[model samples]
Target: MSTENGTIGSQGEVNGDVMLTHFRKKDDDDANGEVETEETQVYIENYKDKLLIYGINDSPPIHVTIICALQQGLLSLSGQLIVSLLVAEAVCASKNDAFKARLLSSTLFMSGITTFCMNIFGIRLPLFQGAASEYVIPLLLMADTDQTFCTSEPSKEGGQSPVPATTTMSPNFTNSSLGNYTNNDEITMDRIIYNVQMIQGSLVLAGFVHALLGFTGLIGVMLRFVGPLTIVPTLTLIFIFIVGPVIKFVEVNWGIAFSTIAVAVILFLYLAKYNMPVPVWTPSLGFRIIRYPLHQVFAILISIVLNWLLCGVLTYAGLLTDDKKNIGYNARTDARIQIVRDNPWLTFPYPGQFGPFGFSGAAFISCMIATLISVLDSIGDYYACARVCRVPAPPKHAVNRGIMIEGLCSMLSGAVGCGHATSTYGGNIGAIGVTKVASRHVFIATGVIYILFGIFGKFSALFISIPYPVLGGAIVVMFGIFFGVVISNLEVTNMSSPRNIAIFGLSIFIGLAVPTWAKKHKSPVQTGHAMFDKIMSMLVGNPNLVGTIIACFLDNTVPGTAEERGIAAWQVSEEDERADVDRTEFNEGYEVYDPLIPRSIMYSKLMKYIPFLPYKRGNVEKELGNVKTS
Candidate 1:
């Protein structure tokens, strides 16, 4: 044991492994220098082992930044497009090619705006914000409850509704035909518009509550009970529940889908280590050969491009038939080619662009629940991003600020009628790990690229034209990675403990089983009030939210040590554990997340009162002393 000032640090053996314990001297005169045993466990992983080519603060050359930005932009665009397409199908707007194209553009626009604002004023991490897949669950539930939309679902028997046959196949398809909406088309458009409005209003309300949670520091208090067991089941169930839809998409063209999957797997796994030489010209060095991890960095983008090209070739060669009734007709690249010509050359997404906002009690409740889940996911992503970037976990204030920014951004997404909330893209975080470039500049540049593409309507429409099977294949790999990342949370937990195993297994199994049951037996939650019935049904039907609730309840109530529950590592309090950590190291980590303001202003005493600012010299000293005496 060693004592410095009033702080005490000691090491002891527990189950043959060393455990660190901290204590502080008591101020009471009941005994002679009696000390209180706080027993605050510290689990500091060696983040320095994983070095980066361009760190969080480093700014690469302009050319290099643009190249990296483009790669990240493509990944972000693909993710946003997938979620938008899913939302379109859920709201029965898949047949409205024009509206679907606009929705995709709106999603991209909001993602870009949020990504830019976040890196500049929020977490200051290299996290790319995009449409969250978790919101799809609630939308699916809403669609099921809607009588008009769910009355005769053709997509259920077949796959997603293909582009209308009336849409011209010409490269310059006129907008005159697009504007000729029949009575039936008008009704469908009204329903789609109404559904999007409901989503918008609900997201706006949820974002306000979400922002309040962060601003008031309530999220920090809630974090006390969140652990790996709670997080693992909650996040893993998200991908697990979406398997049916992914399968439906892949079934559109099994051959094309599997080929896309094979290409992704080969590039991401088998050829990850192979480096390709690129010739570059610079004023300092006229020409030079730079070995780049091309396969690793551009794996997903390359796979999509290659498969898309193959699909086009097959379509042109008459191998892929264009019959509307054909099984694999939607696999052809030209299936939705009219979308590109129908969309304007330039466009802007503004609030209430999709008619006035509307609210539904059931939708609001479901969105609120999804907002909470998104918060938890973002917190976990922050930690993972930090670890991957070779930095200490973010401090409390930085995390609170991040959540607040996400809430505000979600509101923007809703206002713009994106029909989905924005959240940190886990795939991009993994990309950071692979590419060894976590520069905020790269992310900011990527955000600019997103904004640019979003403004150019034709570009967004071009991407929206990707074949369903190709996207399905990519979604499979993406969601699979997501599931794997969620499960990786178990690394810090004592998995051997039956207590932990039982909690996770029961939570996931019941979570999945109950949702399946609810789907089969519709109207399982028929309360006296119609609104209440809708709310209950939607809540009960969401596998992620259900699993999260179960995991949190069991994890908190069940008796288990901190180590077994994984809370020891998950709940790292910067304020409470400051005495045990090196002062310089702690400050350095905090600085990484500090705002772009001058240090003097950011660390000012006034900033201490703000819940989201990193004020280093405020009540920290007093809190530490109080903690010692208490």
Candidate 2:
């Protein structure tokens, strides 16, 4: 569908009808449902040709183009994973169907440019730009839980003896204090700083595998292997992974955090209550809700500044003495003075540091295990995107492109010395859903913001200034939206069980409230991850978790992906017998028209057929017929 334009139109569509089937729409803002005439359509198609004619471009956005960037700094492990997912989204989203020619070019140049600036200017790697590793869990479990850092020959119990006097390290590496770490126990900072450059090896390997899989179009098969249930847990993990940390943060700096949150709420209310001003921020870059007050963004801005100032003061006043002074903590960090002495400039994380540290029989095994989890996480992420995009599933190529980019970034991170594997986060997906602008270019714009930090270095304080509580507030609000979406995405086949629903919420409650309460009460474990791992270990240290068990039961094995498992479900369909309905959906070319299928899904599928350059409308009709005839 189109509207009147100068000579033609600008919107998403397939020019070559033979292979490409495009279903156009008038953007939601265009309330008028005027259809474009054939003549106008032809002109519009030619215009698209001209855009492609200019030669595709995807370099990092100019440094001065963007104004601000949101940095998820020092989150809980799960939160870190979610944050990494978000970071990956900002990066990978830049690579649309053009095979990321633009994204690759942009990323390569941006990375190099940033690396050079930090090297030359003696500049800090703007604390603003951080790549998170969702796979750090496995890597951390291996490296952090390893015997290398321990003192007394590593016993089974948690605490260990002081170093043997022969070695330089202590018994409990997690407890940096044991070895006289100067930065107290800033494990999050220490872990990422020391490990950033090393994770690149895992990233490169992951990228290679993902790219290979993409070329072979394995994403589809892999997707079928993962099911809604697996997604449920993974997403739940993601939610907890994301939101749990926020709650803990809220608990820690209650005055600063809660105050920041209160203002954010009031700001949201004001914005929501007022008549929004035009172009407060672009609809693409920010959500310009008609119902919300445009000025609340400023409230958020003010809150960020005030909280930072307060935190800076608090740290000075001994309120944050634990982390600032870093006395009897862990995470292998030394004092501020020592950090300055070891390396004046914080180094970017390298690629190979993440996968079991060194290449060994055991290291290899650990990396492989980590890789599997990465793949699993990636699969879930892809589906969440697919659901959001409204495609039944992603085209294999798209999946590969996305995954390869994710792995590639991880590989690069390994080289950079960070503990991150940036994957697409459902939380960001939630953001997109809330904003309702899924243009890949906008995320590309976001990555530009990430790259800009190294170029200009202005936004670090903006990020630094954001109070943990305010960040927590934004997270809780958005994730609440996402949790709703996931539940909506699922079938209620088992919803009747208060027990099952409780089981689902059990994870959420345990994951969120327990950690926050534990932290507020001053538990021995500093971060939520430590508490979670310890709790899970106590409850059941099963190599295969409850989620794994359910996925196996419903799907019967790691059939390798969500799609393969889908086919299995398809084969086992008792829908006809159960509901006594006709099933014409299997035969190829049968078209089923369901008005309920979101337009986004239809459009996404159509994009896949574009490269082939032509399509048979009858085939789509036939495809729809199968479902309709049913």
Candidate 2 stretches with Cα past 4 Å from truth are 1-133, 150-203, 241-244, 262-274, 278-357, 361-363, 385-393, 454-462, 491-546, 557-630
lDDT digits (tens) for residues 1-630 of candidate 1: 444545544333221111123345545544765655444534222222224557788777787789888767765665787689888877777767677777888888888999998899998989899998888778878778655553332232324242232341122322332343323444444445556766788889888888888888777777788878987887778667667767776898999999988997887678665656656664744666655555655666688789999999999999998897876888899887877888889878888666556676667877888898898889878877776676666777888889999999898888888888899987787767656678899999988888977899888778777888888887777656655656777878899999999999999998998888888866878768866777678888888888889999999999999888887776656474343545333322545787777655654678767877766654655665665798
> Which 10-residue window in model 2 sums to the lowest lDDT?
586-595
Expressed as tens digits, the lDDT of each residue in 1-630 for candidate 2 is 345442333343433311113344333344574644333222122221121111111122232112112322111112432344333322222112121121222232234333222212211111111233444344434443343422213333554222222232122222232232222222222233223223334455654664455445465565545555555654565554544446664654556666665665565444433434433343333543222222432344455556556665665665564654332111111122231232212122222222233222322334444455556655555555444433233334344545444555555544433334444445555443433233333344445444543233223222323445545555564556557667654452244545345444544444444434433432324345764544433222212233444443444432233332233331222122123223232111111111123433543447444321112233555556665798
Residue 581 displacement in candidate 1 (angstroms): 8.4
TM-score of each: 0.80, 0.51
List CA RMSD, all candidates.
12.5, 14.5
Per-prediction count of colliding residue pairs? 0, 94
Q: What's the CA error at residue 230 for candidate 1, in Å?
A: 1.0
